[model samples]
Target: EDKTASDLFKHYQEIFPHGNRNAASHRWAHFVLQRSTQMTPGKVAYFFASFCPISGSPIDPTPQTAIRYESGHGLPQVSGGQAEGIIHHCCWPCICDSLKFLRVDTKTVSTSQGPHQFRFLVYGNPCTDPTRIPAEATDVTCSNGRLEASVLSDHGHVIVGMLQDNQPSIGASSREVLEA
Candidate 1:
């Protein structure tokens, strides 16, 4: 049977009583529909990474990590176990890149050990616009021959890869990584 938007909305409300019918929530619902229509049901995997000159403190250098994602459209809601597995499997490279990006420092610090003193900064959100880094997050600096990157969102566990200066690196992987 065909369902109207309102019908779907009502069904959703019944399923997610806690959901607020605000603009953002409505948009999110629409986004789900759009993504579902475009996607073919199948297993998928992805990976990402970045490098920075700074080094995280041995004690607590890594930044706080959080995964923001969504699953389910035509299919039943993903179980907690499934979601946990997806997050666990997908979050590593992103976290690693984030740590790498946060550690780059332009001004060199003198240490008792080495000529270059590298300190790691906590990774924050990712941004398409490099001009704006999340307020709580530090900027990824690439001066003095250093670069760093952090993962912001891997919503669908899609893989993305890109080449920078002819170096092959994983950008975002969606299906290819899973196949591998």
Candidate 2:
């Protein structure tokens, strides 16, 4: 089904009802349009993350964690089934601090804490025209680094492992899944 801005906004509202009623969801819907090929409300609901992976903070109504992403591959398995994709968010401060030492030539974002480095990868041809890039993207790679060992919420022992550069981490077992 072709996802319209209305569809996106409606779904976002269903999942995050307390968020900004119109403006914020409208903006978020517009942002998703650029990156997704087959977008649907179900997909949005399935992929959206409630917290910022970097700061582990609850995503704000304006979604202060402006850096949002959708990764369709390379995520840990979940109990219900494999996750088709992950929609994750991150704050600017957390991402900027992590990318300060990024070596673009080597596709690595290193941190000052030590030898920790993330292999950042882009799915398509690198965008040569800065103007062509989406205005919401913080970096070309759309990811800074593995801000934490895990990005999953405290919904029991449902999450595990380090998140891939562009993908958010989620590990679920049967115990963590509730029948819908």
Candidate 2 on 1-180: residue-level lDDT in tens? 444334443554443344332112222322332333453333333223333333333343222333332232222232222222222344445444222211111111222232232222111122333455455433222123321111212222212112222222221211111112
Off by over 4 Å in 1: 26-31, 34-180
Q: Which candidate is the best by TM-score?
A: 2
- Pairs that clash in candidate 2: none
lDDT of every predicted structure (CA atoms): 0.23, 0.29
RMSD of each: 21.3, 17.7
- State the lDDT of candidate 1 residue by residue for 11-80, as single tens digits: 4443234443211121222223233323221100011112111211111111222221223211111121
Candidate 1 versus the native: TM-score?
A: 0.17
Question: TM-score, each model?
Answer: 0.17, 0.21
CA lDDT of 116 in candidate 1? 32
Displacement of the residue 101 alpha carbon in candidate 2, Å:
10
